[model samples]
Target: MSSAGGPAIGTITTEVPARLDRLPWSRWHWMIVVGLGTVWILDGLEVTVVGNIASRLSESGSGLPISDSQVTGLGAALYVAGACSGALVFGWLTDRFGRKKLFLITLAVYLASTAMTALSFSAWWFFLFRFLTGFGIGGEYAAINSAIDELIPSKYRGRVDLIINGSYWLGAMGGALLSVLALDTGIFPENIGWRLTFALGVVLGLVILLVRRHVPESPRWMFIHGQSDGANAIVEGAEKEIEEETGAPLPKAGRAITIEQRRSISFVEIGRTLFRAYPKRATLGFSLFIGQAFLYNAITFGFSSILVKFFGVSSGTTGYFFAVIAFGNFLGPLLLGRLFDTVGRKKMISGTYILSGLLLFVTAWLFDQGWLNATTMTVCWCVVLFFASAGASSAYLTVSEIFPMETRAMAIALFYALGTAAGGISGPLIFSGLTSSGVVSDAVVAFCIGAALMVAAGVVAVLFAVDAEGKSLEDIARPLSQRTKPTGRPAGPPSAPAV
Candidate 1:
């Protein structure tokens, strides 16, 4: 066996990963998708409400005395900063503990923070709660993306991930509509209405938490952690259920890789793995994430203000515009996600990015010429974001799939932290300042900057995008515990370790 104090570091061979990858798509899989995937919707809901309510929050009696810029600019930045912090901290914990455990805990954190945000009577309290809410969402990203990649079949991974991540817009749509109703003076008072909007998030989070409780721990994770029996039980149960549902014989499972089970991996090792072993991919992840982060944050957080300042749209009416934009973002992934797997990741990613950037540039020109009113401006946003949303969703799919399983969560966290810090935190602030200036030229400059970033990221994707479609995770990146490193390993079935 092994020494007690040294940690149980020994090789164990298992087919859990292969078994999971080979299973047919069934209702059981859909359950996992819906239960675990709803976190994105909650995030979308949170962000959309904040953006839509920025104008209302600055009113004389809206509880918080913050200016419109503070709500959309500083407030958005703080939320992103908190998300960055949470991703790093919780990402490490997820890899150390388990996906199911961290996801549950993270959602609870979100529920508590969001509920308390509704009770805030001051700027500091509201800002603190918003940060906390962001912390929960950031943690959810790491845990959820890791678990989804581990459990979903390789063939369907790309589409599934895109659709799930894109569902954030579904929540955005809901928030846009809800805020419209909530902000109406006839439906609710100014002070009470905004508070009620946040409180509704608590109710949604509670329902999602109940659904998440039933989602089992990742079997691949269990086996890696040395619980082979537990892993086998989970996979077997899934196979049986799928087979019975389909009324067909299941195919033989793929080969299994042998791994030396380690109780925990250190931060230093994780860093080395990212920077040293996968430097090119690290660059790719950063490029994809930052580009999308800047474009999305700038537009989403500041869209309402642009409507008010440039288009003379009322705060209450901005939700209808946002709802239309949200629908476009949601449909991008729904309509185009299959291409990432079928047509290949590189082409689709690059095409979407570049096309979206061009559209943004054209829209900027139109806005500068003063040829577009509120309706036309929103349509332009919808078109640009439709393409950008799908491309951004692919960014997450790329980072999650290209790295080794051991460092999966941390890798995602690092890119998200870096990208969000670089783009997300600054995008809103910059755009808010530009939009608040009420100068079309300044807004045009901001749009140009976002467009340039997206185009540059597209070029990077063409240069470094990994050809990972329809391939198993093991094929893409070998486990760190393997006897052979990824570069030296040949294309063949994995062999069992000597007992």
Candidate 2:
């Protein structure tokens, strides 16, 4: 392994970013996707398992000494708090050290924390472990998003990011299915079944860690940090592999942007970039993130409760319904993701957000009219989330793409922390209260609120979203330290036929 070593402080210009962007897709890209994208699945699995087993955790025979409210309420709050804190701390570290390093460390943190969660006997212990688990997952978001955007070709960046982030729903579906088996009393003891759920996620994380070990550091980060030799080696290796796979010549390298290399970046500069230099983009990021966070956290946290309260559904059966909904969520990104590249980011982003919000509104009205049963309501939710899921995933894609390279991780961390703080904490509490009220009108009001926010976010997207589709990260926002300026040409036009 090359030491990702670079200068302490200096200036350098390199075409490493252009070289990486010009390469045709090959097995190497898929390897990057699988190794890095699995974190979201682990996150979705952990979250879904905990939500599905909240009832089991509260049972006297489940070994954990915790009430249902404690498990679902306080525990969830601690996890979100930890995630928010971790993003800030790790986001800065990712920018300072390197993407590959922090991503590996974060996954290790998640594997260790989640494995420990199965051994927790008391509520405090369980809460602590959950927080630690979230902390790791939060760090993964910052590190992985940066690395993926840097490595993936700009032309395919949108769809790749959407699909990768959307992989969260795949994990959700897996968790829902696993919960049905693991939570079944016939299969295992009450205490052991739920424990097995946490263990399942740990096993998956371990596999991902092994795969990630073969993944390399972001060469773009290396070049900017004054490690030209290391960056050139990586890009050359990738080009060779890709050419062998495609059996053709690679595209002409694009013009390189010159940049000043710095060993350290201050939080003050990151803040300046967001609020001072790119205020509208900053606003767009907040609106998208907060709206999606509120909608997702609310529904995901209260999904089973809604089924039980409104439709006389059982705890065990909720997983099946949620699984069906999770499938819809996954399909949204897989099917529609390509449009983000071809149709353009702003239009597609706005369309998904607004359309999903409208669907949710219609679904809310149907529920209020007493026209929905468990099956029909699940179907409606599936339709609504099919669009909302894509929109939500795009929010992460948006924040990750629109910022400068120096503060890219921190920018994502900033929006995620703020959005999660605003919506992630209060959303579940509000929805839980509404669902528990036994009044359809109360639940209807909650749904309407989420719908309205989604619509507003869509409007914001229309007004403020960056037209970043098929654009390089460097083209989208020049690095803070970039000394050379562009002269009306994109990092050179595509030099080879689109593969």
Candidate 3:
């Protein structure tokens, strides 16, 4: 048992970690991360495109009754609302059905909804379609992430997930570029831009479907679901390719657990596990999730909010400009992908939190001082997003690893749902309410408040976070090695890390 009164080594059954050095990765691993990440990117592209288009809707030829900002915020609100609902429902479904199945299904929903959204005309039609699209994206968040956690090898999981997670910015950047280019063309009318932007999403979705034929299921989930026969089939398939190259016996299984920590998982059951496991991991998971939900979403969703109203930028200029910022955000993760291994999860995450806060403060300061003009402000926002995305990307990686695989998805869903649901609702709401209330005049003032919130996020991580880099799932879950005291207290994540 752990020093904290959790499971002892002999208490529950789990696979033993093999030396990562001996393992060879097949294309399957990369495909899973990149493929799933690409789906998220498409979702991100659609979202950014919606933001670009919503800002122009009322002024477009269709003549929707609402103002562009109103449509944008309302569409976002509906989107977030759909996500909140999707998270609650799909988080459970992903856990119950397994990640890969749900991942593919959610992609289909997103593709269909994006097509519907493109065809929207009236305000109600647009709102409904966007809400549905957000709902699918919400489902994607849980399924894609859970699938990545289960599919990838433990040693490289964090880095893989980070790079994949980082691709959300790629989608955003793609949308921004397309929107800008389409707008600059002048051949297309104003309303046509939104349609073309959404059409790009359809193309991306089709690409995922074609490539998805090559993707595989989660062997871990198969193992847990009493499908060891099926899991072995997958392992054997991966093994065959490796053996071909190395001319050797592809290594075999970990020490299997006698008693699985997870029994039956449902959404309500997940809630029970989070609180009932009375596990520190569970509680810490919730807190970290809550903190991230409050900060990350607020910052991401609030970006357009700041640009449109607080920054006093014209509608025509904002979408194309924001696109550049999105490109940097995409690069931040893809370029720095290796740091999770070299720097260690604790320091990598801690540094990201602190640095993001510092950047946020800079953005706020520049805006408050009237030093950041449109060009400068856009650059600063992108830089802040780059760092913020880094920190935000890790929250899922850490949260999934902290729990045992038995309850891993449940824990992930619960924590993510709690944070994201709260965040999904709060981010746009807070920015709109606070800014519209006139409590803050400058965009920097609002950003200052955001930076302060991020500072809290930094403090939380440094105090609670532990380094998980290079550790196996078992090493993380019960921590057999570290807590070198009277009783074996596995080293937990340092206090914790958040958005």
TM-score of 3: 0.85
lDDT of 2 by residue, 1-499 (tens): 1224646445555677777777778899999999999889988898788888887788889998897656666777778878888898899999999999999999999999999998998888999999999899889999999999999999899999999999999999999889889888998999999999999898999899999998989987887776656777888888999888988989777466666776767889999989999999999999998889888877887787788778888787789998999999999999999999999999989999999999999999999999999999999999999999889999999999898999999999989999988888787777777777779999899899899989999999999999999888899999887877743333323431111
Say which candidate scores most in TM-score.
1
Alpha carbon lDDT of each predicted model = 0.89, 0.87, 0.65
Q: How would the candidate models be sorted by TM-score, starting from the highest? A: 1, 2, 3
Best candidate, lDDT:
1
- Judge candidate 1 at residue 81 and give its lDDT: 86
Model 1 CA deviation exceeding 4 Å by range: 2-9, 484-499
Q: What is the TM-score of each candidate against the true structure?
A: 0.96, 0.95, 0.85
lDDT of each residue in 1-499, candidate 3, tens digit only: 2234322221223232232223566665667666777886886687676666555666636445556545545666778778766765677787667777887788888889889888876778878888888778878777777777666676678778887888887888787667666554376776676677888898889898777757777666654554444555766666676677677876545333333323245556555555665355554455455555655555555455466665677656676777788877777777666788778777777677678778888777767666766678888877877777777788778777876555666566667767666655666566555555533344445566567656666666776676777776655664222122222222122331000
Candidate 1, 1-499: lDDT as tens digits: 4566543455766666677888888988899998999889999999999999999999997877888999999999988988999999999999989899999999999999999999988999989989999999999989999999999999899999999999999999999999999999998999999899899899999999998898989877776776666777888889899999999978866465667777678999999998899888898999999999999888889999999998889999899999999999999999999999999998999899989999999999999999999999989999999999999999999999898888888888889999988999999989899989999999999999999999999999888889899998988988787664333222234343321
Minimum summed lDDT over a 10-residue window in model 1 is located at 485-494
